[model samples]
Target: MALQARALYDFQSENVGEISVREDEVLTVYSEHDIEGWLEGVNSRGERGLFPASYVQILRAAAGGGAAGEPPASRYANVPSVPPPQPQVAAAGGGGGPGVGSTFCPPPHHLQAAGGGGGGGGGGLVQLTALQHQASGSGGDDDDWDDDWDDNSTVADEPLSGSGSGGGGGMRFSPELDGPGRYRVSTGAGGGRAGAAAASSSAAASSSSSSKSTATVSRNLNRFSTFVKSGGEAFILGEAAGFVKDGDRICVVGGPHGPEWQEDPYPFSCSIDEPTKQTKFKGIKSYISYRLVPSHTQSPVNRRYKHFDWLYGRLVEKFPVISVPHIPEKQATGRFEEDFISKRKKGLILWMNHMTSHPVLARCDAFQHFLTCNDEKAWKQGKRKAERDDMVGGNFFLTLSTPPTPLDLQEVESRVDGFKGFTKRMDESVFQLSHTANEFARKQMVGFKKEYQKVGTSFRLLSQAFEMDQQVFSVGLNRAIAFTGDAYDAIGELFAEQPKQDIDPIVDLLALYQGHLTNFPDIIHVQKGALTKVKESQRHVEEGKMEPQQADGVRERCDTISFATLAEIHHFHTIRVSDFKTQMQHFLQQQIQFYQKVTQKLEEALQKYDGV
Candidate 1:
């Protein structure tokens, strides 16, 4: 791949001297001196340089930087120096460089630029010169110093049979210097020949260890190997057809890494307290601790991990509804990809977006490993059924979902569109809308019925008491007339002489009626009794036990009248009684015609309604 420089003076410390890598090779710069050790002082090429106040600030932002215009006030210690008045880049269409005449801004100022998605630049082993070593020693290299010094103290090269230690019990060094160019050195512990042998042996041992221990330039080669068998022998798998039984490397893309990548590739483990011995499968040997690294192309496009974390966390805190439980686990080892798919891993949506960028990965067997969780669930159900029928309480076997596989970005795009389509379908579905409306209407009706019963019971009891009072009123009026006939007759005769005074009999009768109505124990007792029932009924309803039958009983006892209907009737009664008294005033008119006519009507109406 062709390389491009990110900044004008991308520098690296090679064995010779500082090398300026400009627009020719992949390069990246770090503000921290320690990164030089890790990257071996290499850099990458891109159109813009993203500035961060501190090394961690830039890294954290790059891991998942916030959306554009978002303030990084807390993570960034220093304010960003904006480029001299240039238009901000739109998030879309490769983040590119500023317009012409723009002066470069320093730390805390982040730049959005276009860069070729070339692999990481070679940060090969650091060439340790004596001067640089003393000034730039990583804490890890301290032990190397002790070991090298110890090696120079050996005395003899005579092999001691089992151990590398010499009979002299000390380190040996061959001291020699080439003429003119190399510095002159000397050996004092043993003979020159023995010192040479010791030095050679030591060199060999160092070479072996360096190969095994020294951090290599992690190759851009993305390979994945899947063990398979063909013709009854072992075979290796690839993105294309399965090959004959020879083990070889197969390249594949990886997923995103969280902010703290150096801490550990996989921080979440299957178990912490439990030993590896407890985690087992019938056929697998050793374990694979999976780590997700973003594909080079996708890294520049989507929101970074750190940004997503911030967004997700902020949303969860602000809106409780977003805090859904049972989110899919990030790490699950020894599990097939198919199993993961069948489990309906929530991340499938995100993973699909990642898959579209790398077409070569579309054919990888690793992709096949991810089992759509739906399929795995169905398979488990089937296996469980068989086990139940056999009644053996024995285990059942089936293939697991595919392993942790990189998704196709194109497929991810399609899946997202599909999800949107599904949501629209649900919204437009007539059955769903109708069902929801029906449920709402049903709940409203239930509430109305409950309220009706509550008020209806009180009215029913009151109506019953009113009817009893009317019956007693008629009986008492008759008895009073029967016992006080002489006095009532005397008053009636005197009132008749002066026709305008006829209202006396009516007023006297009403006064007597009022005395009994005011002191009736029945009215007070019924009102108190109905109130107690109201309280009890409320308790029942609150406890989820109120019933329609109870309401019906209240209605029946109150004469089959609803509360509203009874209220209308009670209002009419009040009007009718008031009108009757007002009309009785006509009986006391100066004209005998009014007095005689009203008296005649009252006697007829009273006799006509005697049974009621």
Candidate 2:
């Protein structure tokens, strides 16, 4: 895809060599290894090298690309742009790039953004006219938006995975608001104007019928300008104003979630004296020891492996969309060592980071219950149930009614192919998972004593996660397929003489969900087949029905499948939640276009009938 340098940039990397790009200089985009915050492009002089992905705005998307579309999203990270800078026409559509797939490939040097997507949507879902043509896109390739797990990226990161906030600085709107390349407002609207007055005084994104009507246009522009300004009231007016925080200020002060850590009780001291001869097995003795430091009048609550394990399960059940960071692994040994306790403490910190990072998980009363609940028995009985609300992950930070900037139609399609590619990988993942389970069913059955219980629980959790993934992919894929078809059908109504555009937003939202669906039927379809092979292999080994050579072959096959499954799961977990977030952002951009169009249409009607 073609891109214009929004700013002057000169880059030299050991991998790609020296290349200088001037502001407004148009160049062809090749690849966006955007996770590392760079772009791959060739200047008009044929000098090709890695340059800052943030330094360019996608003037034109190529035939296929990866990542978020250009237009109508983050202003600093140019994912989406405002409609025409005029009519404010809502562009409700997505999935316009090539179907890029992810691979476990080595990193390319001199990180730079890649190219793809052209003019508009390729498999454009929205066509409002008689001969509706699919919009071209900036081009998406066959690559999926990769997760940052294996990537020890030296550059700044984007929020989530694919279709990050766009800047060519390529970023997204995130809660942390502190990542590199993320945009913020230390100041407000132009000239550091206050929210209300600036909006009242200025005109933005306005249109005029004639030069004589510029003043009227200015007034309308100001009305719209109010919403787009940095730190404007429009962004924060609707934050559940009546909802006060659940606990007292003193409650959250001690850890990453808050400061102060003064109130809650953490296990202070746990020690086991060296064994003295007190057992039948002579010379073996066991005794419990603890020296409690006195501070509060409140009684101390000592938690153990079971309590932590149970809490982990509860977190997994409720926050399926968020990845729970690994807890310190359960060990039969060191149950009472100071070093072990310190390790557990570190694990708790990591766990807290995971829980607190997500908006929904952070606010969970159950999470609070786990951290601050005094009596383990009473809390488990009374407070431990899934906080499974459908409203989880709602963008409360954003004004629900406000529309996002509309993205170009083509850029949207390129994104679809990217999602589809990810699904394909998921399909492979599922087959591998099924195989691993069946292949290892025998080894898993032969019990390793003493630690068997813990091992068994770990396996159960992994299996549950695998099943959960399959369910997520299957459900999302089916719904997406249906909704996308419906969205396509909805487009026909746009051509009606009296357009019933109410369906546009619905269609746009549907398309948005469809684009991000993680299911791949190709792999889903093969699930049964893969499992059958594994069970067969296991059966052959168990019954001794196969020769030694054949048994070895079966084991080898299972081993290969198991390895692939592990890799696939790693990739899947790393970015699935991020993809959901990305999809939602893109959807809002489409909805913004939908709202603007409807608002304009309504206003035009009011003008004609003098309704105002």
* Model 1 lDDT tens row, 1-612: 111124323333343323344433544333222211222223433323332111111122344543344222222222122212211111212222332111111101111121212111111111111011111111221123232112223233212121111111011111111221111111112111122222233446535433332221111111111000000000000001111000111111122420100111212211111112212245343322222333422221222122222223222221111111112233435343544433322242323332321221222222212211124343333322322221000000000011122233243334334433543453355345445544544443454344434444554454444546656546544433332333333333433444223433333333322322332222222222223333443354455444322322221211101111122223323433664566466654534664465466446535634554
Going through the candidates in the order shown, the clash numbers are 65, 94
* Residue-by-residue lDDT tens digits, candidate 2, 1-612: 234444344433444243567767776555432312345556777876555654655554456753354322322232222322211111212221222111211111101121222111111111011111121111111112121011332332223221221111110121122233321111111111111122222133111111211111000112222121211111111111111111211111113321111222332222222222122225243322222121222343443344445555554433222334444455655555665555455444434444444433454555555545565444534332322211111111111111122222233234334545666675565456445544343333332222334443454454444445655545544443333333323332322211112222222222322322332322222222223343554464465543222223222222222222222233334444664465457656755765565455445433432311
Best by lDDT: 2
TM-score of each: 0.17, 0.23
Instruction: Estimate candidate 2's alpha-carbon lDDT, on a 0 to 1 scale.
Output: 0.31
Question: Residue 66 in model 2: shift from native, Å?
Answer: 19
The stretch of ten residues in a row with the least summed lDDT in candidate 1 is: 229-238
Clashes of 1: 65
The TM-score measured for candidate 1 stands at 0.17
